[model samples]
Target: MKHQHCRKAGNVLMIVGLVVMVSSIIFSVLNQLPSIQMPALLAQGAILGIFIGALLWLAGARVSGRERIEDRYFWHRHYDERCRRTPHH
Candidate 1:
């Protein structure tokens, strides 16, 4: 039960991270007033937001195990008895 809860939380965290990253990029691009100090600050903040979002995504992936890579060629599950035996021509 706890693992399920953790997984849900982790997934939510990942979504939040994505939102942060996207918003940062959008705002940074939209703020074209290079002469203003606030725009400069926003540009800097965009960088920080990207970094923070990446960290959050990593943490969430670790907790959720949803990002883990898998080898498609291998499966350890037991096969049917007929599959275990040699095929007869």
Candidate 2:
């Protein structure tokens, strides 16, 4: 389903974001010299990755449909009532 695909893509984005963040941290720590400046893009990568990943994940969840407890309960109640109203087929 489209929802499943979106969810999977979102999960991949999140994982990629985490990897970027970790790598940036490691790179910065390894080059912590008084005379050196960290690469601007390296820092940006972590931020962009995390922000974009979270957004994508949220979008995917929206597309996938809400899974709230109240929603489930309401749906169940509606289904039961509908079933009761229908004549046996």
The number of the candidate with the highest TM-score is 1
What range of 10 consecutive residues in model 1 has the weakest lDDT sum? 70-79
Model 2 residue 87 distance off true place after TM-score fit, in angstroms: 50
Instruction: Choose the strongest candidate by lDDT.
Output: 1
lDDT tens per residue, model 2, 3-83? 678667656655665665566566666456667676878656655655665565555445545435457777766666664
- Per-model CA lDDT versus the true structure: 0.73, 0.60
Off by over 4 Å in 1: 33-37, 70-89
| Candidate 1's TM-score | 0.65
Over 1-89, each residue of candidate 1 has an lDDT whose tens digit, in order, gives 48898899889889989988888877776666565445567789997998888888878887787665422112212334433445434
Q: Which pairs clash inside model 1?
A: none
User: Which runs in model 2 stand beyond 4 Å of their true positions?
Assistant: 33-89
**In lDDT terms, how accurate is model 2?**
0.60
